[model samples]
Each structure stands twice: as C-alpha cells, then as structure tokens.
Target chain A: MKLRIYALAYLLFLYAPIILLPLFAFNDATIIAFPLAGFTTEWFSELTQNKALHEAVKNSLFIALMTAIFSTLLGICAARAGAMANFPGKRGIIGFVMLPLVLPEIIVAVSLLVILRQVLGVNLSNWTIIAAHVLICTPFCIAILNGAFQNLDPSMEEAALDLGESRWSAFRLVTLPLVMPGIISSMLIAFTISLDEFIIAFFLTGTNPTMPVYIWGLLRFPASLPVVMALGTLLVALSIILLTLAEILRRRGIKRAGGTDKGGFL
Target chain B: MGLLSAPFTYAILLLAVPLLAIVLFSFWTQDFMDVNTTFTMDNYREIAEKPIYFSLLQRSLYVSICVTIVTVVLAFPVAYFVSFKVHPSRKSLWLFLITIPFWTSYLIRVFLWKVILGYNGVINSGLINLGIIEEPLTFILYNVNAVIITLAHAFAPFAILPIFVALEKIDRSLLEASQDLGESKLMTFLRVTLPLSMPGLVAAVLIVFIPTIGDYVTPELMGGAGGKLIANMIQVQFLQLNNAPLGAAIAIVAMLSVTAISLLFVFLNRRWLRGRS
Candidate 1:
C-alpha cells in the first residue's frame, strides 16, 4: 500500500514539469507564476503565424525525414547481417557501432565539428546535422530492428532461397514483409529522435537552425515565455503521439513475426 | 558480412574517424585560424594550471554523483512497485506513462524546471500566496541544487527502466520461499531481492552518471553563475575562446574521467557480487 502511494507520487514528480507546459501555454499571463490567470489561446495562434518558426520546422522535418530513411536503411543491413551471419568479431563490431548510444552528445558534437568543419573545411549545413543524426539514430534503429529479425523464423528465408530464388529475392520476398512493420516503427522512432535532437544540430547546423535550436533562442527573451510554453506543449503532444504509434507498430511487428508479446520498445 | 559493408563504412567514417581526430587534435595547438600540426601537451598543462577548469570538473563529478544517487535511489522503489506490486496486464501501460515525459523535448523539459523553480516561478509564488513564506524562495533555482533537481528529474526514466527490468527478472518464488522459512519481508528483500537486482542498479548508475557529466543544457539553463559545469567550460573553449585544441583536451579529460570512474564502479560491483555469493 505504501509502495502504491510512492509510485503515484513518483509519477507526479516526473510529470509536474510537463504538465506546466500546457498550463502556462494557455494561461493568460506573460509570467509563468501560478495565480490562476485566465485561459487564452493567443500563444498557440502566435506560433502559427511565426514565419521563422515555420522555416525551422520545415528544415527540421526535412532533416528528420532524411535521418529516418538513411538510419533505418543502415540499421536494416546491420540487423540483417547480425541475425543471419556469423562473421568474425561480430560482437566487437556491433559494440563499436553502437558506441554513440552512450557517448556524450556534446563530445560527439565537438569531435564532429573538429573533423568536419576544421579538418575537412566543409561548410556547416543541414547535411552535417543529418549525418550526425544518422550516426546516433542508427544505433537505436538497429536495436529495434534486431528485435524484429530475432523474432522471425530463419528457416523461412532459407526455404525461399532453396526454391530457386536469389538471396536478394528471398530476402525481399520473405524477410522484408515480416519486418515491414518494424521498419516503419524504427523509422518513426528515428524521425522523432532526429526531430527533437538539439545538441548536434546546434553545433553542426550552418545558417538555418532546427526547431529545437529556434526554441532555445526563444528562451532567451522573457517576453516569449508563453509562446515557448505553447511550443513545448505542441512538441510534447507530437512526441507522445509519435512514440505511441511507434511502440504499437513495434508490438504489431512482433506479433506478425510470430513472436510472443514481450513488451517491446516503448 | 557483405551486407554489413555500407553501414559499417558509414559508421567508421563518421563515428570512429571523429573520435580518433579528437585524440589527435588534443595534442596540437591552435593559433587564431592556424592549427599547428606539431604535437604538444600545452593544452593539458593549461587545464592542469587553471583553477577554473579544475574546479568545474570537480563540480561536474560532484553534481553527477549526486544526480545519479538521487535518481537511482528514488527510482528503485517506484520500479519495485511496478514490477512486484502492479498487475501484470497494466505493466506496459505504466511503463509507457513513465516513458512519455522522457521522449518529449529534453531542452524544453530543462527549461520548464527553470520556470518552476525560479524566484517568481510557480513554487515561490504559490508558496507566497498561501502564506507559507513571507518572501519567495530564492535558493531553489540558479544553483547546484537546482541543477541536481532538474537533472535528477530529466534522467529519472533512464534509471527506472533498468532497475525495473532487473526486478522483473527476479523469481517471485524465491521471495515466497524466504518468507515460508520465517524470514521477515524486509529481510527477504535485503537477502534475496537486493543482491539479485545489483546488475540493474549498476546499469542504472552508469546510465545516469555517464550522461549527467556530459550535460551542458541543464547547467547552462538553470545553473546560474556559480553552478556551471565542465561541459560549459568545454563549450567556452570551443565557441567563445576559439581554442579548439584546448577544447579537445578538456573533452578528452572529461571523457577519460567518466570512463575511469565507471570502470571503477563496475570493478567494485564485481567484487561485491563475488564476495556476497
């Protein structure tokens, strides 16, 4: 009984800041103090009309889309190879590829800036941000897709191969259909991560900033607090929706692959 | 093996190359636009001689330790509740709810803590209005405490999930057997449950500790003047100071510190496990 109450409080503590976003976004006050200011939708309306925010959002969307596609493609190769092949040093190779998952974003951002901007003398642009995003997002994609591949019956692909089919044809015909839901789920997840990523984009982005960078700029001016709150509310809502969809698809992929429900990635 | 070539090549080019570049760059000196390729330890020496850099590193380690302890210790009970006490059918729903806040904009979440803890922020104003205090509380924001609180909150899910996974894997029959043998519930938990969950606890510690030291946002946002950390210093060296070599040196130092500490933690845990078993 005590544990139940503690869990309730713990959830409350975890959620209080997120709850404040929508509360203050609609509150009819510039200051975020809690005096029960009258509700207003002005902040949301303001966000719609902001041209710069729109531009940032567009840039972020493009970057996120590219990141999702490329990372999932890379992840498919890695995951497929991992599940099917017994290559030498495979464990070490996979660990090395997944190193970015735990490395500090600042360190990654700094090192990439040094190598790309300084050594290569390449102009900082959205492409650099996309590259960094793909590097980070690929590990997560591989993690998700590995589950999809693990749940599949390896014999199904071998059977297709034995029936006068090329390896590529067998994979395309037998394996791709099974992991399609997983592919979509991983893509959605990668898209969400790339969309919300701030540190790498902040470092590598050239002239145009991503949405999170734009929000960080807005945070500097006190007058834009409510608008920032409004933006936060929208982003939180979007992320929750995307992740819920991704998790659902992930579970569906597990079921489709004839795997038991083990409560896959959330 | 053939299929892994493309992604492996990309990973090597982007990730591995940059890491090696950092190690190489740390030894070189930069003067204005020109980076002398000649290797030197001047940057490392500068870091050692400078009081600001050393103090910031110390504070970062301290803050990270505090945040890890706060997050993991607080999260353990909540994880235990969901794993052992909650209905099996509802576990996914509970885990999902816990993870929703984690996926939201991390930048915004840190910023919101600044709002909630500021001088005229929610807590202060609410307290003032309720006559709980004559003046708004000023200590909650813009200090190390605020940084710890914001970080502990942000990384709560990371700590909880690993511990929850560990707890979920424990055999419930062991607990029943302990109780059947006349052990108290607390004793059963201490003897049978805690030892089994140490792996998850260690993972939680590393997950929280490693990233907490690298955090530049929370300190920059909520850490007022005195509360700045090593990442902020690393940022200054790269962006404001235009000393990429020195920045690379600091990054290397911070990374090594984290790696050493984490290794030591794991080593100690191994010993503890062996000793117990």
Candidate 2:
C-alpha cells in the first residue's frame, strides 16, 4: 500500500502538467482555470492563422529535417569509427564526442554565441542553429548507431568481400542495408532533439524564430496561454509519435542484426 | 566513399572548429578591436572576487543536491514497481507512461508549474475552496521551493530510468536466497536488493545532479528572485552584462566545481565499494 502510493505520487508528479496541456488547449476560455469553461478547438485553429507562428513552425521543421540528415550521416561515420575502427586516440575521440553530453547547455550556447559572433565576425542566423544542433545531435546519433553497428557481425562484410565483392560494394550492399533501421531511428531522434532545443536556438536564430523560441516569446502574453498550450500539445503528440516509431525501427534492426532482446539507449 | 568523406570532413570543420576556438579564447584575453596575445589569469580571479558568484554557485550546487535526493527518494518506488511488481508484458506500458512527460516541450511543462503554483492557480484554489486558508499562498510560486519542485519533476524520469535498469539487472534468486535464509522482507530488500541497486542510484544521482546544477530555465521562471542560480549569473554576464570573459570565467569555475564534486563522489563510492567488498 505504501509502495503503491509512492509510485502513484511519483508518476502523477511526472505527468500531470503534460496531460493538462492538451486539456487546456481544448478549453474555450482564454484563462486557464478549474471547471475549464467548456471545450473548444479555437486555439488549435488559431495556430494555423498566425503568420509568425506558422513561419516559426516552418523554420523549426526545416532546421530539424536538415539537422537530422547531417547528424545521421555523421553518425554513420562516427559510429563506424567508434564501433569497428581500431585507430589511435579512439578513447580520446570517444570522450571528445561525449563532452557535450555533460557540459552545460548554457555554456555551450554562450561559447557558440561568442565565437560565432565575435571571433568569426559571422552573422547569427538559422544556419547557426543548424550548426549548433548538428554538434549536439551527432553524439546522440553516434550513441544510437553504435548500438546498431555493434549488433552487426562484421564477418558478413568479410564474407561478402571474399565472395567476389569489393569493400565499398560489400559495405553498401551488406552493412548499409543491415543497419538502415537504426539509421532511420537516429534520424528521427536527431530531428526531435533539434526541434525541442531552445537555448541554442534562442541565441543563434536570427529574425526567424524556431518553434520553442517563438513559444518563449509568446509566453510573455498571458492571453496566449491556450494557443501556446495547443502548440505544445501538437509538439508533444508529434515527438511521441516520432520516438515510438524510432523505438520500433531500432528493435527491428536489433532483431535483424541477431542481437539479444534488449540493449539500446532510451 | 565520397559521400562518407564529405560528411566526416563537415563534422570536423563545423563542430570541432568552433569548440576548439572557445577553448582557445578561454585561454587568451581580449581588448579593444583586437584580442591580446597575452594570456592571463585575470578572468579566473574576478570569479573569486565577486561575492555573488560564489553564493549563486553554492545555491546551484545545493539545489542540484536537493533535487537529486528528492528524485531518488521519489523514483525508487516507481522503478521498483515497474522492475519487480509488474508483469513482463506490462513493463513496456509502464515505461512508456514514464516517458510521456518527456514527449512534450520541457518549457511547457515548467511553465505549467508556474500556473499550478501561482497565487490563484490549482493548489491555492483547491486550498481556498476547502477553506483551509482565507487567502491564496504567495510563497509557493516564486522561490527556491518552486525551482526545486519544477526541477524535481523534470528529472524524475531520469532518476527512474536508470534505477529501473539497475533493478531489472538484479537476480531474483538472490532475493529468494535471502528470504530462504530466514530474513524478513525488509531485511532481504535492504541486504540483497539495496546493495545491488547502488549502480543505478549512482547513475540516477549523476543524471539528476549534473543537469540540475547547469539548468537555467526553471530557476529563471520559478526562482523569481530567491531562486537565482549560477546559470542566471552566467547569463547576465554573457548577455545583459556583456562580459564574455567574466562569463567564461564563471562558466569555467562552475564546470570545475561540478567536476571536483563529481570526482569526490566517485572516489567516495569507490571507497564504499571497497569496504563492502
């Protein structure tokens, strides 16, 4: 009984606000309060009409899509290196890859802001957000793909080479096809990270705000709460769908690669 | 092959170059139009001189420690349920539920707390409706308590995931053996289960601690005035104060403090493990 209460409380604390977002988004009244003042879809409808919100959403999607492609491509290389290559400085390189995982986002954001703006004398733009996302997202890609690559048996590639195939041909025909699911998952995860990212985008994005930065700006206006909640609800649904799909692909890849039942980063 | 090399070079050029520049800038000093060639410890010194710097650093550390402790205390039971009590087929459902919070925008979740804990929001309204208090409580929203609550909520899943992993790794027979040896249920749990879960606890602590200390958002929103942390000070230095050097200095200092504390924890853990062994 004690354990049950504790578990319920913990889970409630974790999820109450998140669940409430969708509730308030559908609420008719602009003011978020108890009794909710009947349900309506106006806030969700309003999201489509707002020009700035639309542009921010477009910019966010564009950045996420591009970041996903670049990060996954880089992940393919880095994952190959981390998993298969027996090169010098491998441990050091692995640590370097994981450095951003521990370093504060504030520090990373500030550093990038200073270096890009001051040292390079470059203008801050959507490109800077892309650059920042790629830096941060690559590590996640490498982590996901590492699990994918590690599950792969290199002997198959070696066998292909022996069976009248070149190394590049074997890799393309055998290895790439084998880990495609992981690659897809990595792309999705990278995209989600880029989309949800705020601090870096807040600093780096130019006149065109990304979705989260736009939301932060909207937060200043109290009356926009319902719309913001509606937007948040949409983002939540999209992210969950992407992550669930990513997990499914990851599991399929692992099964095809003949790994044990469970081993992958969440 | 060309496709592979192209992306590899881009990562090196784009990611590696900017990060390396930051490290180099941290070492060098800037003045007027040009950065001075002379390297100095002046930036580091200023961090020591600013009284608010150390105070905020301490607050950040304290808040993270508090969050980690609260998360561990809160998460252990939920993790225990999913790992031990739930049937194997239902485990994924429970885990998915844990991850639902993470599916949303984090900022949205934090902002929701501002509403819940606000003067006229859910908690206060509920209390007022009950006639427990004649007026809404003003103390709950904009203080250290609010920051702690929001951060704890943010990090709860982090604490749960690792602990669940650790709990899942426990051998069922070990607990059986303890029970077979005539130990009480609580004794068996303490002796058999708790010791084995230490690794997960360590992972949970790090997951909660590291990010909480560096977290700037919750402190900015919920902390109002009383909950100001190191990240806020660093932000001030970087953006509003327009002092990159001092910001870098404070950041470096904050990083070192975290590193030192983490190392100390690892060392103490090692000793504890050794003693146990």
List model 1 lDDT by residue over B35-134, tens digit each.
Answer: 9989899999999998988999999999999999999999999989989988887887788789878878989899989878988788888888889999
User: What TM-score goes with each of the models?
Assistant: 0.97, 0.91
Deviation (Å) of B175 in candidate 1:
2.6
TM-score of decoy 2: 0.91
lDDT at B123, model 1: 86
DockQ of 2: 0.46
Model 2 stretches with alpha carbons more than 4 Å out: A1-5, A85-89, B1-38, B131-134
The sequence of per-residue lDDT tens digits that candidate 2 reaches over residues A200-254 is 7877888888999999888879899899999989898998899889878877777
Task: Kindly give the number of clashing pairs for every candidate.
Answer: 0, 0
lDDT of 2 by residue, B1-277 (tens): 3333544556456556755666566665657455665678777776778788888999899888888899889888899998888778667668867875764698898999988998878899999999999999988889988999899998887788889989999999999998998999999988889889999988888777876777788898899988899988887876676667767777777877887888899789879877987
> Number of the top candidate by TM-score?
1
